[model samples]
Target: MAIIGILGTPYNTVERSPFWWNKVSYTRQSFIDVFQELGHTVIVLPVDKTENIKNYLPLVDKIVLTGGADVSPYLYGEEPHAQLGTTDPIRDRFELAAIKAALEANKPILGVCRGLQLLNVYFGGTLYQDLSLTSSQIKH
Candidate 1:
């Protein structure tokens, strides 16, 4: 079975023993289901300290960046407009490092939703300030 590294959704945390995790992906479970259906092993990686991504990246054959949060507008070089959504700065840094690590390691990389935006930014590209206001009119 191909070992695939699936990034985990970052969640809000609670203050106590019953600390809670926030939901960060629309397709995390779905990806797991589909991957298992295809007979592959899925390894989930949650947000780790910025310096530790390399510890996990090398153990997998491929990297999959799942969707969640708003990509910080600053990342793509734009100021945050009123329409900008929630942002996860920690996850942003981690994923950026992960993607770069993936490239240096020469592993296959798959990105979804915000992941797509991150990839674009990492490659010296910019994002559409507003998808609906851009050339395409499809609702996300």
Candidate 2:
């Protein structure tokens, strides 16, 4: 059976400003169940580690980059923006390492929301702030 490695998102508190609290990584029971129904195995990977990533990368056929925080702009050569939200530098480094490994290994990667933003930044792209004010005049 093909194994799909799913990256887990961090547990954050909305009340705490820039909270970087406890993070739990696991392939949700429902998610795993769904994959089993499809005849594949769902493998969960911690998005907070460099070593665990290396150990899991070789075992999976595909990589999943889940959405969470902002990718430090420094990774793409820019200072932080005013509207930028909280980010995890350590997590950024770990995920970046995983991304590079996935690319080198020629494994398919699936990114969601913030994950997509990270992937874009990883590939030398930029993000827009206040889309309505900068690009369009749509109201909130």
Candidate 3:
């Protein structure tokens, strides 16, 4: 069975005692279920700044960039637009580094939504801050 590494998103929670807690989350259950159904093992990779992702690369056969927040505009040398949604710079940095390491190791990548955007930016492409900014009649 292929071992798949899935990147997670970050979220915050407030305790009943007025204390705040931050956590890394992977909300998409379908990703895990579908992969398991297809006979692959799923591993959720949390947002970790201390761990060396390269060390984990040898354990996973493929990487899946799950859907999440908009990528930071700074990565592509642009300023954030007024309509741009929330971004996680920490996640962006981590994923970029992970992607690079995975590519160097010849690991296959599967990107969904924001993951796709991140891949584009990593390869020297740009993103439209907001789909509405475009004059196209089609709505996103």
Candidate 4:
């Protein structure tokens, strides 16, 4: 079975939670179930545990960057827009590290939702931090 490294999303601890805000990185159970059902093992690449990201590169056949908070616009050399809402810089750093390691190792990577945005910026692409910042007629 192929091992899929899923980059975990970090979040603020909810009310009554014990974990510190932005200290936990996790993938949803549904993601784990779906991958396991398909006979692939899922490993969570935690945002707060990026120190060992390079070591993780050799263990998985593919990397899965899941949906999460908006990526930091600073990563793309742009200042954050007032409407940028929330962003997890910790998660950004973690995923970028993972992406670098994955490319150097020749491992395939998949991006979902916000993950796709970050991947684009990582590869010399830019994003309109907010749709309002763009001149496109379409609005979100």
lDDT of each: 0.82, 0.76, 0.86, 0.85
lDDT of 2 at 33: 81
User: What RMSD, rounded to one decimal, does every model reach?
Assistant: 3.0, 4.1, 2.3, 2.3
What tens digits encode model 3's per-residue C-alpha lDDT throughout 28-114?
Answer: 899999999999999888776735787777889999997778999999999999999989888898889889989999999999999
- lDDT of each residue in 16-47, candidate 1, tens digit only: 52444544332357889988898889989878
Flag regions of model 3 displaced more than 4 Å.
14-22
Q: How would you encode candidate 2's per-residue C-alpha lDDT over 1-140 as one tens digit per residue?
A: 77988777665545564554645554456656876798988888876668667787988998777766777878778787788777888778888788899999999888877778889988999776435337667663
TM-score of each: 0.86, 0.76, 0.90, 0.86
Deviation in Å, model 2, residue 137 alpha carbon: 5.5
RMSD to native, candidate 2: 4.1
**lDDT by residue for model 4 (24-140), tens:** 778899989999999999999767556789787788899999987888888888898888879887788888988888898899999987878889999989888778877788754
| TM-score, predicted candidate 1 vs. hidden true structure | 0.86
Error of 3 at 12 (Å): 2.6
Top candidate (TM-score)? 3
